[model samples]
Target: MAAAAHDPAGAYDLLVIGGGINGTGIARDAAGRGLRVLLCERGDLAEFTSSSSTKLIHGGLRYLEYYEFRLVREALAERERLLRLAPHIIWPLRFVLPHDEGLRPAWMLRVGLFLYDHLARLRTLPGSRMVRLRTSPVGAPLQARLTRGFLYSDCWVEDSRLVVLNAMDAQARGAEIRTRTGVEAARRQGEGWIATLRDGASGRSETVRATAVVNAAGPWVSETLGGTLGIDSRAAVRLIKGSHIVVPRLYEGEQAYILQQPDTRIIFAIPYERDFTLIGTTDVPYEAEPGPVAISPEETRYLCDCINRSFARRIGPEDVVWSYSGVRPLYDDAAANASAVTRDYVLDVAEADGTRPALSVFGGKITTYRRLAEHAIEKLKPYFPGLAPAWTGDAPLPGGAMPGADFDAFLAALRREAPFLPDETARRLARAYGTNAREILRGARSLADLGEAFDGGLTGAEVDYLVRHEWARTPDDILWRRSKLGLRTGPDSAARLAAHLTRGRAEAA
Candidate 1:
């Protein structure tokens, strides 16, 4: 088993940089394949681009315009696989695309939806069907001008929790996961690669050696490769910033809306946190540091305008309760428009003289991250000739072993066991922790045993579970990654949590 403390001089079969979905997925896959793996992250898992996605596990419907047939098909297939494998956290969702003659012609939209439905052999989700806007509940929130729309199936995911779950599974499978540990430098050493990492909190530096290295740092991929390892590859990553705004729920149902903007770009207004609407996404080219990616005033206004144009209710800045931004590290395909950049990922393996190999991932989406990991490990198969064959397709992620993978039934069971807990709390715990919800609420007969209530449904026991098992080091991990309590919890709650964390760390030291 890999040690908890970083041993700079220790050797590893693989050292994966980045703790996002792609990186954590690769580490989990590689470790399961019998490779000694060590994954290092400069920040918390999914703190960057991975957590900021539109939080859909859908096959990119717009990719059809770019003629990315294969990519779309593979992503569509993965959607079903993920829904089955992690039903507790990922489930089916319906999207209503209101007709807009100015953006996309009705015939063209029909063709796209048709192709989307038929692209993958969908067995579980319902196919696309035209709805009468005047009659359907999905159309109630829309303007009266829109008479008809199409409702299609997709899957919604708890994006950040997905990353943490991957890391947890990887750790359970014997892979070491380190958060807030930055790889400061790396270089070729003998027939292997040696790297130095520093803990962000303590500034403690350690050296380690690895037979192979994977650069899956998302937006920092290029910088980590060239600056840390001194290897320059021809493949480049294009950074496109996308933003999302959360406002009070505008509709009562679970159905989401995919609105068509006049500029030919599509924006999604989805149900979030049960009481909020998540409207997002602009595709502007970005060139800033990956951290501190915040939604801009212009982007907020743009999203609000799109929503107001489609729905009868008009929302403004004051209505935006929360906002976030993330950069998509797309493969630089030399496309003139950022929206046209390819969502497909590219793997670059630098093995000069066939001695030391350093693999770097270019671009990938959350929906296709599992496939990306499988492909990445396949690339390293030549080095580890005895590695296990791909198996994640049939494997269930941690906490996803509900019978038939039926989330509703699992929630019913949880509510029966914890009758004293609020219905919402029981459902949230079951969804977030699956069968492990019992472990979190162990020995607790009532809500008071769960300890201090922070925000949303988060409790002290849940926070402690995240810190002990999920590699969560800071309060933000609990607020943002494990749960979106940051939006519901006031700033004062955050400060109190921070103080508690500081005290806990001091006592542990």
Candidate 2:
């Protein structure tokens, strides 16, 4: 571990390592609370586990079976809060759960959905309703044999953009945000922490001093603490890998499907990007390094089989258009099965000799990141007596503060302004960039003025905006993280983007 360098002035109030949802959430909250904060990520914002989520701001209805009522209720409440805060990015999504006799009984699911609806007094989203699948459009994609089902509500989010919006909000609130910067080491000084950060692209190092350090590295939490800070953290992080497959839209309606497998785990088939269906999530113990998590053949087969079993149309491995994997840094609870492990997060604050302190976050889900940030900062309130009070419950993230936070109205306004742009492009920009869509279209009057088209609905203007504002560095960062253009563009488009990025890099140099 590196020793603390001598500094005459006091160090920063907090230094957060990692640009994932949790890290950015913490940075935003801390900065909002009048604390001097600095956040650093070794790669692009949400370039790893954060962007690879199922993209639902859900309460995890299945967790009720494991008696995680508190976790479920908290997340359920947050779903509504996020909808109010970022209506452009997070909106209500109804889910259809088709009853299968072989998997779970209908009565049990009814009770689960009942508890889910009432657990948190939902305001904007409607309550759960029993459905006759034979008469409903949600049943069209399923086998004719399925006659009964239930409909419930959750929220969908642009997962990667959520992280970027959080980081942008933090930066707007006086927090120093650094992407492609790795925390080399951190050590306890007399009353603060001295840390070394290295630029990943250029290999340049800069020393920083901070009053406290938060290890919110998501999957890299344990490794960061033990390796970078030399702190023997008591909390253990269980690495469970989850994978998702995207295919052309198989269903017609806006509703998603929650299919119950024989193993008792539920697989989600969500309508994604207008023309694609997103199916996901196999829980397997993972020991691989934290970046570029790849979907294994076993996972691909498992998801395909699960989807095929529920729907009339059979899907196979070859039908998969795109796939992604992410390791959930779950808090270790000694669960025998990886699927049974808890998704709840735990915060451990270590203070040696009643002076220097280091806070380590164990596990968290995308749905509960905002609440987790508030709780994490609450844990450190005593250390910083002058820190402001908690206040992230109702705050708007960047690009989310449009009139009434109403997405439909915002879209109507944008369409009137940019009538020449395709309706699809206008809606996409409004949803992804919110009020900033004007900035992206700055001087463009026609499609030609927007510059080259790299992929479906992707253009040079959007790419430049991402590179300049969203911390997008490489082509993959833009295609995969900033947007899902990779799915629409295919392998060749990546090469074209690479060439464009290379030229931009050379011109800048």
Q: In candidate 2, what are the lDDT values of residues 130-161, reduced to their tens digit?
A: 99988888888899878999999999999999
Q: Report the number of clashing residue pairs per model.
A: 2, 0
In model 1, the clashing pairs are 8-207, 8-208
Q: What is the per-residue lDDT of model 1 for residues 348-376, given as tens digits with 9 covering 90 to 100?
A: 99986886789999998999999999999
What lDDT does the true structure give each of the candidates? 0.89, 0.88
Q: What's the distance in Å from true for residue 293, model 1? A: 1.8
Q: What lDDT does model 2 reach? A: 0.88
lDDT over C-alpha atoms for residue 287 of model 2: 80
TM of each candidate vs. truth:
0.97, 0.96
Model 1 poorest 10 in a row by lDDT? 1-10
